[model samples]
Target: MAFFGIFALIPLVGVVYFSMVKWNGMGTPQWVGFDNWSASLTDKTTLNAIKLSLIVMVVTWGVQTPISLLLGVFMAGRQRYRAVLSVLYFLPLLFSSAAIGIIFKSMVDPNFGLFSHIPVRWLQQSYLSPTLALPTVMFVITWAFVPFHSLLYQAGVRQIPQTMYEAAMIDGASPWKQFWSITIPQLKYTIVTSSTLQLVGALTYFDLFYVMTQGGPGDATRILPLHMYITGFKSFDYGRSAVISVILAVVGLTLSLTLNKLSGTGKMESQQEGI
Candidate 1:
C-alpha cells in the first residue's frame, strides 16, 4: 500500500497537476489552467495520433484474439509432436520487444533487409513508407504479442475438466461441436482477462514504435504514446505531453473498468479475497 501510494498514486496525481501547467522539460511548471489540455485537443498531430491509436487497438485485438485462442487450444493437446512445435511458436516470446523491433527493422530495410535480398518483387517494396507503414506496424505487433496471449489461452484450455470433453464425446458431439460448446464456454473468463490486458497494453505500446518505425515515414505510425513521447522529449512541451498521458490513462482505465463490469470478474475477485 505504501509503495503504491508513493509510486503509482503519487505520480498519477502529479501527472494530473502537471497536465494543467506550462513547462518545458526544465524550469518550474507554471499553472496555466487547462491550456495544455486545450492545446493537445486542438492539435492536428494529436488527433492523428489518437486516430492511429484506436485503429491499432482495434486491429491488434481483432487479429491477435482468434489466432492466439486457436493456437492455445491446439497446444493444450497432449500430442508428442506438439512439444517441439509449441517451443518453436514461443521463440518470439523469449526476445525483448526492443530487440525484436531492431531485428525486424533491419530485416525490412529496403536496401539492406532480408526481403531486399529475396527475389520476390512484392516483398521488396518499401515497407516503412507512408502507404505501407501502418500495416507493417500492425503485422509486427501481432507477430510479437500473439505468442504471449496464446500461452494464456493454453493454460485456460488445460484447466478445463477432461471429463467435460469425455462426456461431450459420449453424447456424440463432433470435434468442432465439442470445441464450440465445451472449449469456448470454459475459456470465457480467460478471454475477458486477456482482452482487457491486450487492449489496455496496446495504448501504451511505445518502445516498439520507438525502435522500429520511430513513428516514421512521416507520422504514419505515430500513435498517441509516440506522439506523447515526441511532445515531451523531442518538443520539450512537458505540460502538453502530460495532457496526452492523462488522456491515455483515462482511456485505459475506462476500458479496464468497463471490461471488469461486463465480465463481473471484479466482484468475483472481491468475493474470493474475502474467503
Candidate 2:
C-alpha cells in the first residue's frame, strides 16, 4: 500500500492534474481542461505511436512467451550442462537496457556496425530503415527480455512436484505428453504473472528504443513512452505529454487487472495429485 501510493498512485494523480493544463514543464500550469487530451488523441504522430506500441506489445508477447517457456523448461533440467546453459542465458539480464540498446545499435548499423566489415553482401543492409526498424527493434526487445521471463518459467517448472512426473511416467506418457498435460497445467499461475508483467512492461518501454532509434527511421519505432518523452522533454509540451501518460497508465492497469481476472490468479486450486 505504501509503496503503491508513493510510486504509482501519487504520480498518477499528478499526471492527471497536469494533463488538464497547459505547461512547458515549467512555470504555472494554465488551465485548459480536455484540450490537451483532444489534441494528443488527434495528433497523427501520437496515433502512430499508439499503433506502434500495440504492435510491439503483441509481437513481444507472442515471440517471448514460447521461447521463454521452452527455455525455462530446458533450464529446469538437472543436467550439469543445463546449469552452464542457464548461466549463459542469464548474462543478458546483467546488462542495463540502455547498454543493450546502444550495443545493438552499433552492431546493427549498416554503415559501421558488425556487418560492415564482414564483407557479406546479403548481410550488409540498413537495419534501421523504415521498412525494417520496428522488426529489428522487436527482435532486440525479445532477445533482451526473454531471459528474465524464462527464469520465471524455470522457477515455476522446478516447483512442480517430482511425483507428478513419476506418475506420468507410470502412465506411459511420453515427454511431449508430460509437458502438455503436466508441466503446462502446473505452471498456469506463473504464466499469468509472467504474461501480466510482459504486457504492461511493453507499454512502458522507453529507454531501450530511445537509445536505439530515438523514434526513427522517421518515427517508425516511436512507442508511447518514447512519444511521451519527446512530447514532454523535447517538444516541451508537458500538458499533452501528461495526457499521454495518463492514457498509458490507464491502459497498463486495465491490462494487468483484466489478465489477472481472466486467469483466475486470485482463485487458487491445487494442481498436484493429492494437494
Candidate 3:
C-alpha cells in the first residue's frame, strides 16, 4: 500500500493538479482553471475518442466474455484436453503487445502477407478504413484478452464442488440446464471481475492502435489513452492530457464500483461467512 500510494496515488494527484493548468512541458504552467476541462469536454476529437472507446468496450464485453465463459466451461470438464488447450490459448498473453501488433500488421499487409491473396482484401483495409478500424481493433483486443478471462472463469469453475454437479445429474438436470442454473450463477463473481478488467482495459487501450492504425484512417480508433498521448507528447498540451487522465481514472473507478455492486462481489465474503 505504501508503494502504491507513493507511485500510483501521488502521480494521480499530480495529474489532477496539472489538469487545472496549461503547460507545454518545458515552459511555466499557466493557471487555466476549468478551461482545459471545458475545452476537452466540447472537443470533437475527444468526444470521438470516447465514443470509439465505448464501442470497443461494448464489443469486447459482447464478444470476449461469452466466448471465455464457454471455453472455461468446456475446458473444466476435460482434464487432458484442458492441459493442452490452456497453453495454446495462453500463448498470446505471453507475447508483448508490440510484438503481437507487428505480427498481425504483417499478416494483414497488402503484399507478401497471408491475407494478401484474399479477393476482397478485408484484412489489408481493416485498419486503413474509417468504418472498419475501430471494429478491427476491438476484435484484436478481444483475441488478446480472451484467454486471461477464460483462465479466470476456469478457476471459478474449478472452485465449484463436483458433488453439486453429481447431485444435479442424479436429479435429472440436463447439461444445458446445469449450465444455466449452476454454472452461470456460480461464476457471477468471475464474470464481474473479468468484465471490469475488460472495461477498464478497453477504455484506456492504446498500444495496438498506436502500432496498427495510429488512431487513423482519420481518428476512428483514437481511444482516450491514445488521445491523451497525442495531446501530451505530440501536441504538447499537457493540461488537456491530464484532463483526459483524470476522466479515465474517474470513469474506471465508477464502472468498477458499479459492476462490483451489481454482481454482489462485495457481499461474497459476508455471504460465505453466514453460510
Candidate 4:
C-alpha cells in the first residue's frame, strides 16, 4: 500500500515542483520561485476560476451531504428492502460522468429539452443566469456523487453498535435525542470521510461540468480544472497551468487533513471513546 501510495503521489509532487518553475511542456525548465503561484493568484481569470470552484464546492457540500446522509440512514435501517434500495441509490456511481452530463444537458436544454417544456429556459434564461451557472453544474455533480457518498454513509452507520441505541432508549431518550447523542456521534468518522471525499472530488471536478456547460455561456462555469485546461492546452501556457494544478492539489489535501482532524478519525482508538 505504501508503495502504491508513493507512486500515486509522484505525479502530484511533480506538478507542485513544476509550478515553481517556467516550462512550456517541451522546453528546458527554469526556476521562478513563487512567480507562477503569485500570478495565478492575481490574474482575473484565475481569480474567477477560484471563485467558481469555491461556489461549486460550497453548494455541492450543502446539498449532497444532507441528502445522502438521510437516504443512507433510511436505507441502512431497512433490512428487508436494503439490497434493492442500495442498488438504486448506487446506480449513478456505476455510470460514466460523461453520460450523466449528456443527460443533464438535454434535461436543461434551452429549447426542446425537457426543462424547456416547463416555461423557463433553465439553461439559457438570465433568471438562471450564466453567473449562477456554477451552482447549476454543482447540482448535477452533486446528484452524480450522492449515491457513492450514500454508500460510504451507510457503511459508517452500520458500524454503530445497536447497544448504544438500546442504552439511549433505556434512558428514556427521544428519537431526536438518541440521534443527537448516539447516531451522530457514532457517525462522525463517516461524515468526515464523506465530506473530505466530496471536497476533493468537487475541487477537481471536470467531466460533468465540462460536458454540461463547457464552462459557460460565457466564462461563468469555469473552475480550477477547466482553468488549467484553458491555460495548458487551449492557451498552451503550461507553466501557469501547472501552477493552478498545484494550488488545486494543495487545497484538496488541506481540506482532507482539516476534516480528518475535526473528526478524530485519524486517531481511531481515541475517537472510539468520544463517539
Model 1 per-residue lDDT tens digits across residues 1-275? 89877888877888866754433422326767777777889999999999999999899999999999999999998998887889999999888878888888888999999998899888889988998988887898889988888998999999999999999989999999999999999999999888887888889788788888889878899999999899889988888887787788789878888888999877322100000
- For candidate 3, lDDT tens digit of each residue in 1-275? 79877889877988866754433432326777788889999999999988888888788889999999998886676679778888798888887677777887777666766766777744545444788767767777777778878888999999998999999999999999999999999998888877777776676667788998888877877888899999888998888888887787678777777777888757321100000
Off by over 4 Å in 3: 1-28, 118-127, 267-275
Candidate 2 C-alpha lDDT tens digits along 73-138 = 999999999999999999888888889899999999888899999987988989888978899989
**lDDT, candidate 3, residue 13?**
83
Residue-level error in angstroms, candidate 1, position 8 = 13
| TM-score, structure 2 vs. true | 0.87
Q: lDDT per model, in order? A: 0.85, 0.85, 0.78, 0.76
Rank list by TM-score: 1, 2, 3, 4
Worst 10 residues of 1 by lDDT: 266-275
Residue-level error in angstroms, candidate 2, position 134: 1.0
Clashes by residue pair, model 4: none
When summed lDDT is taken over every stretch of 10 residues in candidate 2, the lowest stretch is: 266-275
RMSD of each: 5.3, 6.4, 6.1, 5.9
Can you tell me which runs of candidate 1 are displaced by over 4 Å?
A: 1-28, 267-275
lDDT for residue 34 in candidate 3, whole number 0-100: 80
Error of 2 at 105 (Å): 0.8
